[model samples]
Target chain A: MEANIAVSSEKKPTWGGGGVRPFGASYGKMMMWFFIVSDALTFSGFLAAYGLTRFKFIDSWPIADEVFTHIPFIHGEFPMYYVAFMTFILIFSSVTMVLAVDAGHKMNKKKVTWYLFATIIGGLIFVGSQAWEWKTFIKGSYGAVKTTDGKILQFVNESGKQIALSDFVVGDRGDDKVTQTRKNGLWFESGESVGQYSVAQVISSYNANPSIQIRSEKIDLDTKQKIILSREKGAAELAKAKLVVEGANLEVNEYGNTIFADFFFFITGFHGFHVFSGIVINIIIFFNVILGTYERRGHYEMVEKVGLYWHFVDLVWVFVFTFFYLV
Target chain B: MAHAHDNSNVKRIWMVFGLLSVVTIVEVALGIVKPDFLHLNGIGTSWLNWIFIILTLVKAYYITWTFMHMEGEKTWFRRAVVWTAVFLIIYLVTLLLIEGGYLFETLAPLVRW
Candidate 1:
């Protein structure tokens, strides 16, 4: 008991002197690491949930190549090319950030400033590209029908190439029916905006076209391609379509499964938000570097810290790119 | 941190960047081509998927070790950060995927197409 009392008394002074540094790391840096680890776990939870749900609907999941094929101002089907470009931009930004941190270590404010500026530009480009990608995805390339049983049926040519609704869906929509608003209809609140073509228009147009066949979402294990229905069966299935889906939303997706879009929006949006914040933080640090605050302090630890965060964001994108685009 | 400001360190950074870029290029090429041999099922997934996952891990390692300066940190600090995340992530992914597979089996008869 006396020894225990002595040990406790001896430990009090060290405890009062602002706790021990675990592994010689500063308090702020350690706290940042703790936050990062927890944040990483949260991301992992989301991705794991994505993996599980994807596994559950593996048979009907959208092909990543077909879904993410658009590039800005380009009309060709270049699968995974634009996404690879985005990944390279992010990784390059990470490189610039590390260079800035290295420059900061040598007290080279000029070098640090230039590198920081480059990093910020890279980040802005990446964010802009992401927005464009989102717009393309939401706008959709080909229109598909959602059956009453919640299955998506896409249109394809006899050659097995995908066909846009505009290719065969002829005739103008006669009515300009807008979504019902609260003021327009009693007890009705507007939700999402209406799609381009109505179900009736799509059905009639599909029936008029003989070359168009229905492609089911289920992939044939042998061919690794979606199963295409016969012309007669395609017409029969088109009769079961309840709604005309042109693009993706939280509720409906013209792309194979609704859950796939849900995960795509949630995961990529969350990562984009991180990149946005990292740019904001980098801007703040860039100003501090210019103001010579770190010069007076004799160290540019602020740059180093922010570099840590920026690198972390890049790391997460690597995984997101792999799972979402490549896989 | 002080020694990392040297010219060789800059070259090292660029080299790591090259390595990461090469890995990404390889991943993209494989994804685009999807070689017949690589597409064969192995264990639970295709060998191609396993290759992508492994390459992703390699990229993650370079980003953390070089860019984040984990190599400069003390041993315990590095372990504390890396080990915790690695173990927990592996555990979570394994169990969840198993559950997902089971759910697919249960729902197989009910769902159409």
Candidate 2:
């Protein structure tokens, strides 16, 4: 009885210090899994919020195809192409990462180093592509006029092809309104950078160009296209214009709904940030392999742990691709 | 120590890669084409959207199972991670969607342009 009590006392009060890796897993690996579970919930929160807003604006949601139609130097419209390329890049990087982990298990340091290098390169390319996509989204192709009720009004040619602001608005600032700047004692510093032309210019150009028609944000479910106003209704709707919105910002977006842009920026930006951090962590582990740290320690479990994180990132992208781009 | 699992997992990794790549290509094609029948035929949700969701789940399954080596983990640990996340996500999404549909049904009419 005395001997039993001595052993029990030595191991008493081991309440919480994280050696409790359930299922005989290492402490580091189990903790990584915990962090991943929590982070997954965080992303789910954002995606569910997006679903809420989408449902609220179901009738007038912007079509993903119409909004994200741009690739560098290519002229014509090819929607979802660039986003699909990005998805492939991330997936390929994930493959390389898994290979690294597999190599690590066999204690093949050279293969692990090379595969980790490829994964890092893939991550950098994905991040760069996202930056490009954001640029294209913020600088919209076809400018739209905002109604007093804060809805977008786009211009379509007679044949139903969308046209840009510079296409028909050829005159120099037709409106006599002075440009607002700090030097001129204008107190409107709270606004985004001043647009090139005034609302009057867009209005006058739209009025003079009889070949153009107004496309409202509302959709016709049967045809799944934006409802275009007739010639007479077009003129009347143009009169309701309050401002000329060229590109996307918090205040306005040329796309059908401003909330679409907001969600796009937030969700994609957060995912990209995660990818960026994963790249950094992989680089740290890669150096450790070259320095023979894992060799001395007798295992390459660090690579395996980091691989879990990399695959988690790719898993998140799969959902993002489905919801954001595909559906 | 001779590891219990084979070190020749390179083949399995490539097979998973091929599967993921093929699935992604199919998804991108469907998105671009958006066939009329699939786009229109559903009780409340479109058939095309359902297909996309199902395919995405399949891809997610493989990624989690093979790439992350979840299949090699203990059964209890795997269930602990997957089940908790799935249940919570579904619960939250269902409630939020209900509230959103209510707003659209009741409040959208009141806010006139």
Candidate 3:
């Protein structure tokens, strides 16, 4: 023992082990913060790119209210209600996560387990809600016609109320035009969208219904509304119709610009993935808590580390909500 | 660690949650109603958009400070993370938005995009 003491006394002191931690942070905690900082920059790059695209297409960007006015089960228009609920759920989860950290600090295993469990549940629910939103967005509500110049043309009634192509276009096109695959004849094909109403059917049905007017994708900046063409102009524009577009895809969008859908999917998809991984990490830590790992280790710094990440996700959501939904 | 045994920890968490909820509700209300003056006036966008952005920043602040426990960290530590992020993000956003605006001004007149 005297030999060991002499050896320890002869050793040089390290920074953290000697209680000389720079910034009063443990090495692990400091590293986690650094990771968060870099992760935050990645998200900022995406959001700023989104902003850039939005600014570029400011005039024709889809009105958010018109696109995201969905609430499951309870039909009818409730703009921002569902998303607001989602925001509350995420914030509540964040609260639970912070509570878990607080409980961990007190070394109360039971409270920590309960709070962490609640946090996981909240995360699962949020992810599920996001999936539902994506489904609705992908399936779309109304369909539109694409012109030769790639302009999307939708329909509104005489009173300027938006109408779907299905609202008036008789489903049966009464023609037997099969999809042209690459093997059919030419070396290439247009990759025609099958099982959809043809442009001719939509245009003919549109002409038959005089009450329907064409709404252009272009928004009048001063009004912030899609431009509704006059009946004559609507007929003229209908003559330029090439294909029918429904829902959203990389090449087309029923909700105005395709880039809008791209950013929506990309940004929210990335955030959702973070939430998912956070849940997995939370589960592992929850098991650790049950096993008394932190209690045995003398500190619940792991819980605190994960808590920082959970809150960071919530923080990003706040900005995403503002930019994508509200602004 | 200092607040470990203190009952104030739970109280602070709930208080911040309440504040965040109220702000979100106010934002939703404003978004739904969308007063004409707020939507119509402003230079680049509108007053309503500015309000949303500012309120979003406020929410971000609370989430970072209290929920993320950033305020509890040493001052220099917090600065190293926050200042670095804020500066970089602001620089990128300003330049990208300006570039996007320039493109809009130049290309929009010629092409429909």
Candidate 4:
């Protein structure tokens, strides 16, 4: 064994010995890999918690299709269409990133610059799309009533198509309840923005509209749809209304379980923050490339390192797209 | 850094992009249609879910191997990075999912269906 070790040592110096590259990978790249692995575990933890909560509340969980059914520019229900477009944009940006790295390897400055430009544009569009999605989610399409027991009751027609609050609700809210902002109220205290409608108005409106039926948050396993109540049952359920919920927030969600919206915001917000920072880093690296920093160094290893990070962001989005939208 | 002449593999890069795009299209199509046969039956999840998970893995493999240039990486580097993640993520998912199932069973009676 000592003879063999001596022979191996005489042959050539191995990596991780006196500033040698380990695993044929540079120090920067290996550190980046370590970051990616730890980040992956963090994401996995979040997803696993989501899975556990979803399973625990399987019966009352919101259906993905029903909640995410909005498309920009168009008004009708187009579930997952915009989300798919966002996914394509992100993936396409990743392609451009790899292309940029390839150009870097070839020392083709012009191609690298242009590809990097394309990638930055793609990232901008994706971040914008995510913002728009968040806006749409916050401004819910079909408003619902929150009962005293913390249950959600949405309205639907006989055909089971969800009807917006504007479709049937008709009455003026007599109570003068304005939004309590920090500036308007005590400087040290504030409250959530007031909803568009009030519980009293909604209750009166529901009492007037006999055609509108109530749909509870609970899903019928056999039908794979939320349980819609009869007209009499609808009125009885509406009588328990404690507040009017127009959109989503940290506390209340018109879609279904409040925890769903909580996780949605936390996970996607964290991911979005990553994408945003990735763009900033890319821009810096893009400028460095334009200034011939890597070219002067006679290697584009910096570009390759950043490419790994960019691709990792894209990779995380793939799983996010599946879990949040597709599933 | 040495293989400057062979650095630009434009054709292979585009081919990988095409493959990823096609796979994404297939995933979206399947998700939208949600064929009844695939959605209704499975061991734990539906066959559709299994298909999605499998296709996602395929996409992940291609991205890591081709775009990330893991294909050209040394064997130990590849194993150190990929194998560690694969094993840990699977283990985490399995334990979490099993615990979640147990929670569901325990709380099934309390929650109104």
Candidate 5:
């Protein structure tokens, strides 16, 4: 490669060749920039397609706030505060990543290692938090009905207050609520597991209730949002009508439209995957630092490159947070 | 070209990050509150989105210009990459919008998937 470049240089003048180093850095940095641009386009395509779907389902689209409700330790329900916290963690990690690069500039191995370690831990924590969120989401707190036409209808009381499925779920099935099963029932004696709640149970419960009336895509008279029954049904019906249905008119979703779930999983999942890779990369770089790779090389460009990647993750999050949580 | 930035330049990066954080917090608050004026008719296509897009662009600009050091690069070098990206993005958005409009038309019956 060096001989080729030397021969090519000896042959003729190529464009703007002003003492440019053949393979020192300029090409790598340019390549990274191109990669970032193309990657950004890929993400934009995903997000834009999401917007297209969202716009199509304007009326039936899931509310971002209501869908992603989980308060770290508080448990029961809180709006998007946990996600906000996660965003902060990621942004903070980006800060530490930058600091690592800064330490690299000073050839401060100890400081660089410390910051890189913190960044890795931060990335891991963010991934863990996202996993926890997915757990809560998949194992939905409250239950809703899956319509025959493939839409989810959540349960709200006569007072129009959202209620948890736990409030209505009956005596222990001991592991009956399962989605995927073995080919043969007797193939494996599956251990008793309190499986994730089902949308079907809510429908049957509502059907059995004498006072309970079904709420369709149409809105209730008073509250405007869909409810299990009319306000006139009152508390008596609310108590006896132990079923609630929720969700929207889309493919299949744990909560609402499958598109919402799809976008949620795809965007966050991709971001989480990036974080995981970032940690792995940081670990490799961390070991390199310990072994004095940069000290011997007399340059910390590797740290800077990794820092760019880390900040790029945070940059993606900034958009995800806006689209998913805000807009 | 070989010059190295000092502590003050690094401090400037921190300042930019601080500004970005502040803007993000404001975005969160707006999202949560969703003021009556913002939602007076409905939250669809309001001034808030404008604020968000503008602020987001500002943050992106700072991240690229400051942290990525695009501002320090040769004019032609910066333009070669940045302008291509900008134009390509605009072109893609246009295509998506047109395609989306067509899809919307067909989706009323075929939209179940």
Candidate 6:
């Protein structure tokens, strides 16, 4: 019976090896599906690890809504709406990608080109939007004061609005004065990278004015966070300060927390990397399509394969949207 | 050169896409508003979380079955792929929770510090 089955399979034209030929799909397409599944699993593992860490630090975890509130070309804080637009872009890209595949099936070159171009533009816009998001994240909003005990105490106005250190950091320093290097004071400087301005500088500048009082990194350094005093006293005490806002656990971030920043960089960076690769692949395929390579061959299976990949990107974004934005 | 999709099927695909987008908007609204009843603060084990998970699963199901055309495949083939993912996800989540709970308890002191 096994020999009979083997003989029967041998009668069919197997494009590639493996007796596990899927119905109505070439070996490449089958492999692509398998590859997509494995990739999906890998992404799931990373996201699950993210979930685990977030759950562990549930109380201290940064608020997603607050952090990702900014919109492109808009000044005010609008939570989730911008990301919603990004989601629409990706979903629309997926639609265009599928439409291209559909056009490919009918062998309509013009329609395929139009749809593919739309998809590519959509992807580019998404990448650009992501870059803007990263810029906003890196710049940070408000700074906090880190205490000797490694605790962070943030400053807020009477209305509980986060006051950016820059709001009070008044100085006329050159670009060289404000840089993010590895070391300015530490001689060891093995990394030998540029360093960001010391938090001390921000505090000193803030203390320069009389209206603002020195708030210790420790909320209970003396008694309350609000210190009442004149300019001379605030500046005098701020000069002797040893600690500053290295990082914090509030909505108003300073260079953001390393973990949050790292995750943001890593996850979005990885996704962006995928988009880059997809664009390269798309470009190659675009050239091929223009050359009428598949058209001459009388099959647009290549287009279909790439469409599957493009849609996979879209599908991943849907989940990323949920996990990173909504959740 | 092949004409696999008829005009009727094309229209159907667009209809499905519209439906999917509508469902997504609904999910987003639910997520954004985070209704009082859906608020998991005092609830047991977070019904909102469960709702979100279920909705996510539904979306995944639609995407896979309809968009990916997995529903058109052979019964055993579909089962093999879907069931493998389902079983593995279940196993992974279980192991993760168990190990995570253990680690959380063990590292509680260090964490507090």
Highest DockQ against the true fold, candidate: 1
DockQ of candidate 6 relative to the true structure: 0.25
Runs of candidate 3 exceeding 4 Å displacement: A1-20, A178-193
Model 5's alpha-carbon lDDT is 0.68
TM-score computed on alpha carbons, candidate 6: 0.77
lDDT of 5 at A241: 32
Per-residue lDDT tens digits of candidate 6, residues A1-327?
456454455555544644455675667777777777777777777677676665554444555665677887778777777787887787777777777877888888888888888888888999999888887776655665544434344444444455666666665432454434545564453453333445556565665554555433221212212333345554554455444443322332343233665666777777887787787788788888888998998977788888778777777777777777666
Cα-based lDDT at residue A115, candidate 6: 84
TM-score of each candidate structure, all chains considered together = 0.92, 0.92, 0.92, 0.91, 0.80, 0.77
Report per-candidate DockQ.
0.77, 0.72, 0.76, 0.59, 0.34, 0.25
Native contacts present in candidate 4, fraction: 0.53
Per-candidate clashes, comma-separated: 0, 0, 0, 0, 9, 10
Residue pairs with backbone overlap in model 4: none
Check candidate 2 and list the clashing pairs.
Answer: none
Q: Model 4 TM-score?
A: 0.91
lDDT of 1 by residue, B1-113 (tens): 56645887889899999999999999999999999777756557888999999999999999999999899899999999999999999999999999988888899779865
Task: Please report, in order, the local distance difference test score of every candidate based on alpha carbons.
Answer: 0.89, 0.87, 0.88, 0.85, 0.68, 0.65
Candidate 5 backbone collisions, by pair: A152-A246, A152-A247, A153-A245, A153-A246, A154-A245, A154-A246, A154-A247, A155-A244, A155-A245
lDDT of 3 by residue, A121-240 (tens): 999999999999999889888898888887789899988888888899985765767667767676764775575688889988988888999999788878788999998998888899
Model 1, chain B only, scores a TM-score of 0.93
Q: CA lDDT of A47 in candidate 1?
A: 93
Mind giving the per-residue lDDT tens digits that candidate 4 earns over A244-304?
A: 8888989989999999999999889989999999999999999999999989989788888
lDDT of 6 at A327: 63
TM-score (C-alpha, index-matched) for candidate 3: 0.92
**How would you class the docking of model 4?**
medium
What 10-residue stretch in candidate 4 chain A is worst by lDDT?
Answer: A9-18
lDDT of 3 at A294: 95
For candidate 6, the per-residue lDDT at B59 reads 66
